[model samples]
Target chain A: MAIYSYDGTFMGLMSLIGFLEDKQINPVAICDKNDLVTDLFEEQEDIKTDEKRARELIGRIVDHICEPAFDRIVYGFLSQINGFEMAIFNYLHLGLTAGENVERLAGDRRVAPLRRLSLRVGREVHRLKGFVRFAQLADGVYYAQIRPDHDVLPLLAPHFVQRFADQHWVLHDLNRSRAAMYDTHQCEIVILAAADSLCFAENESHFRDSWRRYFQTIAIAERKNRRLQQQFMPRRYWPYLTEMAERVR
Target chain B: MILADSAKYDVSCASSGTFRQGRANTLGNATYSGICHSFAADGRCISLLKILMTNICIYDCRYCINRRSNDIRRTLFTPAEIADLTIGFYRRNYIEGLFLSSGIVKSPNDTMELFIHTLKLLRHRYRFNGYIHVKIIPGASAELVHQIGFLADRLSVNIELPSRQSLAKLAPDKTKESIIVPMRQMAGEIEMYKMEKKKYRHSPNFSPSGQSTQMIIAATPESDYDILRLSEHLYRKMNLKRVYYSAYVAVNHDALLPANPRPQLIREHRLYQADWLLRFYGYQSHEIVSESHPQLSENYDPKVNWALHHLDFFPIEIHSADYEDLLRVPGIGMRSAQKIVFHRRAANLSRQDLRRLGIVYKRAQHFITINGRFEGGQSSLLHSLLSERKIERARQLHFDFNDAPSAVQPSITGEL
Candidate 1:
């Protein structure tokens, strides 16, 4: 069987898996179109993203398997970790054959890898939910910039939308160069390179300073454990945290 | 900064158990699973904007930094100032919400009135729907307590010291009756409101997140038995959502208080671990500690210690044992026990399968047997192996503050 490649979009990956299952061909490897190589020793086939096919496969997974299984697949794909595509394909292959029993096989090697990757993405999403700090922009829109490990913008969008329904806010994932913009009525994800030009509001610094003071004073002096503090709130995330970040200008 | 500094000693920063969705006009909302916006230098979760309304006091609580005898700077924030600060910080996602605590200024009734006014400003004028944790001052009238319950998400009245004698020594002004009265009143009101909501849909919630209280540990001569037994009583009788144990940090020099008292974090950690057992695990106060063993072992965790003492309960056949039985095992947790039960119904589980299900096989191997094949060497060996990990961990990671095997927590979810 030839190696299969598809567009990197989640829909494209689903379509590729659906096409492979239908053809009864076990591909050596499944990869994104960008990563596909024209090897002289091996043959490669490129598949286009099919919306209907992807929807049908997702519907079947939800019906035959469980919604949580489908959620695992989506989250695993979002992880963008190394060789995640193949791991997800294997998970899906087992899930399709085993039906809902695939969940019971959480200990199974094929299923466990996907579960691990999905949990990694889930944890990062959970962390960024609290880690993401928004500063009021000069235009009165709340702006936050993050560089999370996974492509968790889509997962983080619904939470911020529900929590900040009446306010205008933008959650910018600097790692992926994508932003989720919300304007009270609607929320949309768009590609944005940088937000260096935007200025913070006049009172933003004052509030930030107060938060910094609160953060410093809240800690018990005798119970000072910098190691433990760094363990919970890692040094990598300190750059963007309002309390941890150093004053600019 | 002054208000926050005075309020820093309060360890209850939980913002969980209340779900208030954002409305058209509201400034914020509460999440059922609380969010920690930041972590402090002491490895504590910075969930709420913990601050006092005022630090000026009429009483002399020896352990408190805001005691009347202290020569420290005292400050007070107007109700409008607190409301503005809460909204300002909330809009920037700097905090979960306001954690309004105050020292006794004039009387508990006057202080409670001020709290109610501040809460009203946040709830009505500002239209803030987020989590608000209010400190219910002891000796406050039931009328004032009833009114404030409707405005806040969670209410707590700090017990401060463990025993009545300790209360007398450390906080003479705070009588046992004064504290328990508000707690009992709030618990009854919460239960009544929960019942009322079933009958009338629009019935407002009376502290939707329920009530929690805190007690300072290690300052007095109270044993682990004394603290845990009191916690059990509070949980059963008052129906408290949580009982926080703050390690005594000596900020005051008093003959009654411990001299140069360092915050007993390890003891505090062990108490929290035992607290989890009491709340989540089906362990009673007597089961954990008794007159014979008043103090918890500094070496092993409460669970491990329990497993070691009860030898006959070990060698539980994984295939035959139920969920509750599995929970008693050294390595098996609630999540892992559930997985074992679920998986064994479909197919036979192997040793490797148990490991995959998130069980600490090294710890659990002694307690459980797979298909009647015991891998645990002997009773004496089981005891050593169970505590070996904690011993090794203590030696290697001395700075690791949390008793949990996992990484330190950023949010106080009140989990085991």
Candidate 2:
């Protein structure tokens, strides 16, 4: 009967859901403000993001459903898949009522879509954890640029922060114009207007050359299988991989 | 690069099995689920910085690229140099950690001492906490082996050959006793340390990721039965974390080894599949292979072959079967079986629901029934359809056609 819109943030979506439940109205669709495509038959309303309501709903979701279901909602929101807002709406609607039994309905249509989105997001997060290639910049900060299909920079910060705790680094997502900067002690996600090209350290090329040579020498010539290599490290990731990068000579 | 090339034949590059959080002063951490930084052209994972400390060997193993008589460029990395390289790569996110192996320069004890020195530099001087998988030198003294175990996350000793006779023929200086005695000692020590840690909270860890070993396949005339039996023994009796199977690639030619050696990649693939059945699927080796069928089926996977042989086990009701029974189906993997068991408790599963639950319905549809409705057509002709699908997959992967060394061919699947 109605279409609901928000400001395209996770908090905004959570607030809109909380507002809808309190009002006892089920919208025909839920979407971000920028993504709303109004239909002639349905009335549209934009919900303001309420921090208190969003936090309360999130707390309730973790307490009632499980921590994993909360993670499912967070990752599904990051996936940016089409109709993910509605999928989360339906999933939480069932989850809040069914309590812990929501996840047991894995094959149910309402829950399966959100689960699939979370899985896709999780797979990308795992792949990027390895695929991220860092190069030492001129100022001693290690910098890496990635063009991942999903918004996964927030998910990747904790891993790199723990692994490279003593090093300064920046992981920039070129597609989103955002970066996660680690300053030897803490990590913060920041927005960048335009991430320009960086100058490498004097001996940066030496290590890169050594790595490329080592990569080539490590493969057994008798079992050379490009298809399998491509399957694991897909061609989309090859542009940034030092080993898979085209030889300049 | 020369050291890495010398050590490339080692196929075990796993960086899993230990979860160490990063300390305040340390440089790295480890995850229980391993991460592959990159895949090589051979489709193998390049997890850690897999390289050798040196490429100078005293023994002349015929199948080894680093044998004493072979004329090749030899290289040695100073302990400081290797530590520096590992730290640099770790900071750059190029590797999980280091997998350090070496050719015995003078003696086993000396080589082990050298490895321990590098590990000490990494652990104490550099304060590195990442995963390190070190190779235990066969014939090393027990004290030295125990010293290295405390510094590394995982340890391994390459059996090199499948059997004692093959070891005698190919690696004349090595013996089965030399290889296995160290393996047994390491297993016992790892067990003891685990028990100690269970009681004591602050006990220093000793090879917390446990031990693994590798054996070369097809270089000697050992059947798949011989190789898998040894792997099964290592898993059951030795409490090994993993057993890697490396198909013979003709790096060196000698009278004792096969001439014009075609790498038995397909056979290696089948053995890995069979190895999975043993470790994760609760299958015994004898059930997979025996005196009658010494080799696995080239036309079908080990699970599918077992399913075809035991036809009475099929037509399992997806709704009513236990988790263990669901795993016996050819295509129902551990994850899918768990999902089925979890979801079917709430409501009945339909044919459509199986696909949504992540089942490879193309393969599972033939073995399972939905709501007591048996839809797999003509049980007698089921194997042909499975074998045909497998052959089509093999063609797509471009696994060599001539690699099928087994006597059974696709034409015989109807009889099977």
lDDT for each candidate structure: 0.87, 0.88
Model 1: per-residue lDDT, tens digit, B1-416? Answer: 98898898888989999988787756778888999878888888988999898999999998888899999888889999999999998888888899999988889999999999999998888888889999999899999999999999999998988899999988989899999999999999999999999999999999999999999989899999999999999999999999999888888888888875567877888899899889878899898889988988666689887876676677799999978889888888888888899889866888899988889888788788999998765434433443666657676867343333231132123331
- Report RMSD (Å) for each prediction in the order shown: 5.7, 3.2
Question: Each prediction's DockQ?
Answer: 0.66, 0.79
Tens-digit lDDT track of model 2 for B1-416? 88999899888989999999987767999999989999999898999999999999998899889999899988889999999999888888999999999998999888999999999999999999999999988888889888999999999999988999989999989888888999999999999999999999899898999999998888888899998899999999999999999888888878788875579988999999999999988899998899788988887788877876676688899989988889888778999999898888887888778887778777787688898888665433444445677767877988654433232243245332
Which residue runs of candidate 1 sit more than 4 Å off their true CA positions?
Answer: A247-249, B379-416
Tens digits of per-residue lDDT for model 1, A1-249:
888898999999999999988987788888898977788877889999999999999999999999999999999999999889999999999889899888888778789899999999999888888898999989999999999999999999988887777799999999989999999888999999995587989999899888888888888888898888888888888889988877221
TM-score: model 1 vs. ground truth: 0.94
Q: Is the docking of candidate 2 incorrect, acceptable, medium or high quality?
A: medium
DockQ of candidate model 1: 0.66
Candidate 2 global TM-score: 0.95
